[model samples]
Target chain A: MSKHTSMALRRPSRLSPDRLRVVVPILALLAMLVATGFLQPRVMSYFGFTLLLRYSLPLLFATMAQLCILVVGDIDLGIGPFVSLVNCIVASWLADQPWLCGIALVGAIFAYAAMGAFIQYRRLPSIVVTLGFSFIWLGAALLVRPTPGGTVPDWLIAATGFRTPLVPMPALLAIVVAFIAHHLIMRTAYGTVLRGIGSNAAAVERAGWSLLVGRALLYGAAGFCGVLAGLTLSGLNTTGDPWVGAQYTLLSIAGAIIGGAEFSGGIVSPIGAVFGAMIMLLSSSLLSFLNISTDWQLSLQGGLLTLVLALRTLSVWVGK
Target chain B: MKQIKFASASALALLMALGCHAAKADDASALKDTSKSGIALSNSYAGNTWRQQMLRVWQAAAQQAIDGHIIAKTKIVNADASAPQQASQIENLILEGWNSIVLDAASPTALNGSIEDACKQGITVVVFDSLATAPCAYKVAYDYVEAGRIPARFIVQQLHGKGNVLVVRGMPGTQVDVDEFQGAQEVFKENPGIKVVGTVNGQWTESVANKEVAGILPSLPKVDAVIGQGGDSVGTYQAFKAAGRPIPLITLGTRQEELALWEKLDKATPGGYATEASSSVPGVSSIAFWVAQQIVAGRKVPNVVKVSLLQISKADLATWLKVTPVGAVASPVYSKEWTIDLLKSIAANTAPPPSPGPTQNK
Candidate 1:
């Protein structure tokens, strides 16, 4: 009698499978907002949103970049320093010579594509290759601007720093980025092919798709988003720092996972990834506002991440 | 490959002959160099402007000493922020037989063993900003607590003992950050009417402070005063300006940009924004150099000597800015006699090194 009752309880509810993909992240975000609101009631206001979401643009772009790699069943460990290199390039080179900076940034995307081809042709693991490339990017950035001071271009700052009447610029940019990412990675036909390659590379190969070209395109797309992330960060700081984007590698991975992306499966939700990044930003700010020490804030962030992912896993298992 | 090898062999032989000739020349000139001392500066980090300025102070002071016939030469080994590299660099300095080793350590404890080894080898080890904890090393550091307290007291007095203040902190968990916050908090505790509205981590970088402070300015209600760590006041002031709020009284670091901004403020209005500035000063490193000179000169010195903080008022902003270049520190260099006097004063202030309590059992 107990087994029958438990089996009945475990049956999938009225919530559709499509809804399941984003529901957890959405709920986690709402819960984070409520928690933050409780700690600081002023956080419910528009001004608080501006403060809380000020740094979300770069993080959102970074998460989207990670999502591209995850969808290709390969992770780019180099995205962090790659972004830092782009930031350094923009802050100094672009600030001085906009035309030259534009060309260099475009050149970097081509380089990323070449990197993908090299990894594919050499049959190297992405983790090892990208990890090695990260050092190269870091070295290149240090060589370009050895210190943490260079002005970001005024045009880039003005563009990203624009504020809508009621909506904060960060929140507005996050929505636009999420919408574009969702359209490209979720709704397009080529997007399905990318996800399918992640799911079964052999099957995709048997279907007469050039795996090499597909991977290059995926990596190149990630490079494009990484550049955007870098630009956003430099714009926020009003300058470039070689060390700024290093922490974003792990953060992007965590955001992608918490947003309902899987490592083995080519499943991801772009809108959910943005929400995930916001949740991360809000959690730390909220913890700080609660007067928690910095040491505990880190552990608490890890704990929160683990709890959310564990809950999503439990929910998925129950539904299955 | 054969041609390359032949080329390299010829180059090597030529280089060896030239090296021998140079060695002979040095030997011939040894009489002139014999009276000068060799000092090595082993810097664990050299990435920031402050470290750069400190290096400049060391180089200038060392050059002055050389010209004055006090020291022969100076060698600076920049570890690029690596503690292990710094440890090995110190060992190299010891083996190189320098008369004195001036160290700006990366971590307080990581280099203690190397420093002790250097000390045991009859090398005078002088540790300055970001100091070493080795007991054998003589330390010259500014009073970091007072660096924080002076700013807090200035802010308190400016606000007439009651106003909302924001604290823009430096790198968290570092001793400088901890001491500064503690000292500021001590002053804040005394003044009950002064409420701390918020604290932001500026990391002692201008852009970081500017962006972080600007982000929170909307949520904060009328910040009357701002207390920030060194290397961040300009950015804090810029944040307030961007927010279209009147710049509150903020303590300036020794950065020349700050003094220039202070000058601008004075010109735009009068009296340099009516604020005060204080810093540990880049020239403090020169004082450390002077102390090393004293030690090499066989003058007994204290194990640790605390340099006092420097303050620049509104009236003196122009004078300070005139001497400091853009982006450099506005630190006053103490004369040789003044350094000796300062060291003597610090030695008298601290307790006498534990008298060997009636010979050990051995």
Candidate 2:
């Protein structure tokens, strides 16, 4: 009981990098579930685990991608539209041509990365550049296949959409991606530089590491995630709409923050992002299960974000 | 003297006959060259296929019209779904003296002032697919609410007035989503048996739709069918499929491909975009035609009107496709002459184009 209360009430000293991340997002997810339960207890049973997995995967991928930017101490307001653009690419261009879809997928990610590079290299504010990129992508998407209607191949649909003997393909994909990301991020010299740059880019520059490359690469990786989601999602849905991209930009940011990518710097983890996404997905799943109005969903998302930040603060206090 | 007079008179008479023939030929050529580039279609964005189709059908109509006709030039601007971008582009065109602006506003409300300004400045603005918050111009749009209600009605029928159903929505604040959601509720009200088990904001993204739909599937074990808004419908179908529901789906935005799928599933595709490539054709052409009509009349068109009726059920889908009049050239029966002939035939002493076909409800 003490351990439960202690863990809930405060963060422990000597926290490991992996452990701190797991704790905070879990706490956040729990807090969300508790708060949601409080708001409407029926949300507990109403939201099944499968529902949680489905809703979180997109945001989960998005958050990890967004985290790549935040860890490098940059903001990507365009993550949402970037995903939208890629989704539009696969939706509009790849629907008819199955074999060429992979090539298009590569092209789309490169396009997103190039846009990110332009911002980082030009020393432009990422926020502004990503905003511009959003418009560019939206237009490009529309240009390729105007209006939102197309046929996705059925076999691709079955392969990506199915949940197997307890694990869905999308959720499994998210797990595999997260694990691979965890390994790659830890090993790369760029990852270390990214953390340092986030802490103090000037000092890292003095040490002769170009923050531009690091920033671009991080943003580039973020773009790749967007593309993956884009292509996978293309196979996942009936049709892709370019306008659909507008929603996830903010969602990725929210999920990353919840995952413990400190807005200031010196903190981020893919594992935590996974948990944050799970919590978020769980909350929405419950909302739908409880049969709540759509208005409440928005309000709850806002409220839940506020609560997560509060828990974050509480984590600091508990650590003390 | 006699010979000279005879030769001179014969030559003069021949010259006169040639002159009259030249005048007749010129008149015939004038009537023959019916195509003109008078219309300027300024689309706000090429963000969706429906809008794309609107642009396509409209453009094809104008292009295939007889030379020097009321249908004139086409300038397509993809605003990238940015309200400011769309507004600015329209404003620029208006400033550049393009008077006939046929627009598909990205945000129905956000584009109001820009459209109204275009109106005040004497640009004939016809909004297609989406409507403004306030009536700014001629809006040829589908029943915005019907876009939502038709699917709702179908599901109600499918579920036999009773079963758990899920709703996947588009962008929450957008006018289309709001109108469609409310429209859905209106139909849902009739069939109390069809209880809306859950509604999730997919935000019109497939990945998000898949996630949201997947999340809810575990809780409501009885959900029979998924109904989604325009962009989000496909996502719900995906999510349900992913979750192994194997339940049927009803989605918005039915193009021919979607039609094929619906038929394959033995489910109704509803009134989807029979008009392929909406942006370059229907939307651009509508703007082109309306603007030309207004410009040729030498009047600032007042209260522009637009029309897009919901093409519903597999039953009505064929008629909708046949009468929808996709642009100038299909392999089967598409010619400027044929379109002109059809429009003229359908005209009740009215403008040739948009002459409602036999299947046209209005």
- Candidates' DockQ values? 0.02, 0.01
Number of the predicted model whose TM-score against the real structure is largest: 1
Candidate 1 on A125-214: residue-level lDDT in tens? 889999999998899898887765567766776776576888888887888888999998889998989888889888999999888998
Stretches of candidate 1 off by over 4 Å are A1-122, A125-320, B1-36, B270-272, B348-362
lDDT of 1 by residue, B43-106 (tens): 8667777777777778887887788776887877776454433554565455456789998877
TM per prediction: 0.50, 0.45
Q: How do the residues B128-232 of candidate 2 rate in per-residue lDDT, one tens digit apiece?
A: 655555465765444567667777777777667888777878886566678888988998888878778888998866678778888877887677777776445
lDDT, candidate 1, at B173: 55
Error of 2 at A223 (Å): 1.2
lDDT: worst 10-residue window of model 2 chain A: A46-55
DockQ of 1: 0.02
